[model samples]
Target: MRSFDSTGVMEQNISKWELDTPALCVDLDALESNLATLQQTVIRNGIASRPHAKTHKTPAIARMQLESGSVGICTAKVGEAVAMYEHGIEQILMTTINATPFKIERAMNLRRWCPGFVQATDTPGNARALSEAAQAAGLVADVVVDIDTGGHRTGITAGQPALALAQLVDQLPGLRLRGMLCYDGGAQHVRGFETRRARTLETLAPATETFDLLQRSGLNTEIFSGGGTGTYNIDHETRGLTDIQVGSYVFMDAQYLAIGGATDDDVYSDFETSLTVLTTVLNAQYEGRVTTDAGAKACTINQPWPIVKGETGMTYSSGSDEFGTLRYDDPSRTYQLGDKLEVIVSHCDPVVNLYDQMYAVRGDRVEAVWKIAARGMST
Candidate 1:
């Protein structure tokens, strides 16, 4: 609505820097490359890509992921799945366990309409509750047993505990046991590639054994899904890994980039940094220091503070509520009022949750504005 284009992009020839300050942006070229790179890599390695939607939380981007050969998209919240479902995104795996009375009702309501919906469970009680709700609704719910691969965030233990849960899911009325989610989320952020690889395999060893246990027990073990951006290349090395739930690869940030890449390059060069925050310098009174409009509210406070794109020796800080501190020891260039700079964010997921929409841009041109439709879908 702001500029001139039939497709809702800004006026022709308007650069991305011309956009409003503190805006979230997706560099379309880098994004497409990232998508194609990850999709091609995972597919070639005989692994399926079921990317997580909680990163961008945009249905448009989810559709892109699906088109790029992602088997489905993963969502951390039930409402995020519901939103994607409403957008006609069929292949969805609800990665979070929801057993609350109202949440169960909501999941059932969604299951009634979403044939591609698959839910995750970690505990026996939650699994039982889900089956009961599914049975009452005359629908059989599909689910994955979330095996905690050292994340300790959710899921049952490996070996006996995990196998028992899978067995229970198999026998439950109105429930179909899809497989297990052995996501080693904790290992994904390990700094060195080899170190991360070792941690992932060591963490996943028992979980893979559990997968074998499920198969030996004659239960459905079709989907042994779990992996993240940091461990995508390394995950396929493990046996029975059906898919890697790679999320942030589509729009990398400072946190992921800091983790060394496959060749141990000290920067995760496997994926490009496609997501960014566009901010304008609001004040430049102090030498070697400038204030930007992107503060904690815009960029979020996860370090190593947001990196000023293409400019080394420049540091960014979102210390203030509405202004960011740009500090430099020596001069690369002088900053002036209203000068725009793009900085890669520390974390992409929660920062995305703060924005209403993100502008997709090609070099010097706005391509589209995608709404973060599930921005605050905490449930």
Candidate 2:
């Protein structure tokens, strides 16, 4: 279906290639496998998963993750968490700092309704603001101090500063300090297994030290939440890590694949590439090159360009808004004007935001079509 609504498309043996151009297709088998693999790893390591919903932006997928043993979910924005909360996702962690009056008010509303909602904050001003609003609402807001592990992103500095923030959050009225968030976003794509592991350990060291400081200070250090799919296997060894916030494991993309894992020297194969932007060849007029309907608007234009599934020696460029140009050196396969191809996106999150629904396909059969309910919910 060209349109996003696939109401009657469920339970049909429809060829994925037959779906409309630039359709988002997910291999259910791969999806299931990825979920199981991560769950198994976390369970075995005595850690829990708080999968980030910002990647899929689907409540159905969030529910699936919870059912697969995820303790809760994480959303980067107030709007995304609100969208998820409306759809029966009770347990959520809003990972970004909600500072503005409007955002804090909206967050308090969500906190009032969902008991499991947790907010992450770094600065004292935001903590005081959240406390003031929460106290006005007559409820205690659950919050975590965001600790900047190494990425130097939005988080308070580790060591005494993190502990101080936690202490401040603890003393703030109408606020319950749950734990610390130490996400090193930069370490998640370090390109080599040994190199990444070293960087991850080095970066997370300060956070672990700060976790100790929080614990020694008699604060609730129960939840030391952080870690991505890249460092999932490595982060379990962290001194205070309780759960990992792995989002992209559900839909491995080109950026993740290039990072290289422990077993694979040049590619991170811990998870399979399940999500793909399905594109149809629109023009085959030129030799050694073809144009597809999925361009920057469809598949995204990130580096390590889209990988043509099941085909080798094919380079894809979606520099244009309307078409992705594909060039192949040798003819392993010939393409017709209508031939459909799937490409593992360079980045899954933004690519997902561009779509309206994802077709859950098992081989050539369509089992379900999950709406991109929170698509463009970024605020």
Candidate 3:
């Protein structure tokens, strides 16, 4: 299926494009709208938008984000950074901790390949390892001290632990202590705006205070990065965040919609539901029940069940490994076999990792296809 450009005129030629059922499909119109909304919002608020690439896992989308005035991109792993760099993304911050020597060597190589490559670590040992690796490579590695705000994840707690780590990073010969990294994963899904704001401040305030302390200690705190699709607006409004690392806003999922961001309205429309699982009705068993080709394998079961778009009074239930059951109370409005349906995934990031390629669609036509190049680049 072929779609026309923004002109709306149908093309006479249709390519022989066939996508397997239960594959991921991205609506191009919705995707572009989502990107524009986030880019505009970040710029309007005077904050640098460095969207995380771990969501889309596509270099094409990353290039678009950079073109939209994003300062850089963030990845969760070294392999992801390498893949993005190979795809022409220059500045990247590996948000996760990299302590292994092999990983440090790889990071140093990446820095040599790409002019701007940064990594975060919370301990002095890892910082020293990175410094040694960079020294061996005859280059300086940009490092950020990861701070534990409230997530209790991989980061040093504020106050003594954080200060000590920052001081050590500064003392290291081949490491440049860039700034502090703190991400409140827990605040991303807080339902109420006030509640989310309160939680974000509660966590981020301490981290910001730690950054202030680092600056007071004569260390430059250049970049204070954190935030996601759920908390981008809140973090932008917050005082100390210089960069917002949002990723899922480009292809919103059902889980983010349930987060109840700044408004009580349907959050799905805030950013269009660009990512979807395209399924075909395979079984029409019973009176009011139908089965689709996509099951747990196609859609992520990480959050609550996915919602069927534009289909009211319909509930989706998992059916084994290769099928999903959709039940509707009204028997008269039943779907027949071979009918196509678009399913909204619960978590866009992980669900996107499940696919190999994403079909870009406009209306009912396919315009382009993007590869999930870094889908399994977890290392």
Q: Specify the highest-lDDT model's number.
A: 2
* Candidate 2 lDDT, 66-181, residue by residue in tens: 99999999999999998999999999998899989999999999998999999999999999999999999999999999998756769999988888889999999899999998
By how many angstroms RMSD does model 2 differ from the true structure? 2.4
Cα-based lDDT at residue 182, candidate 2: 83
As for TM-score, the candidate ahead, 2 or 3, is 2
Segments of candidate 2 deviating more than 4 angstroms: 1-13
Query: Mind sharing the TM-score for model 3?
Result: 0.92
User: Model 3: per-residue lDDT, tens digit, 152-198?
Assistant: 87898888789999999889888888898889888887877788888
Residues 1-379, model 1: lDDT tens digits: 5666554434434678788778889999999999989878887899899999999899999999888888999999999999999887989999889969799889889999989899999999999999989989999999999988776888899999998999999999999999998787788889998899899889999988999999999998888899999998999988999998988998898889888987865889998899999999999998889999999999888887898988877788997889999998665666899899999999999899999889888986888888888999999
Candidate 2's displacement at residue 217, Å, is 1.0
What's the lDDT for all of these models? 0.89, 0.91, 0.83
Error of 2 at 372 (Å): 1.0
- The collision pairs in model 1 are none
Q: Least lDDT summed over 10 consecutive residues: which range in candidate 2? A: 4-13
Worst 10 residues of 3 by lDDT: 8-17
Ranking by lDDT: 2, 1, 3
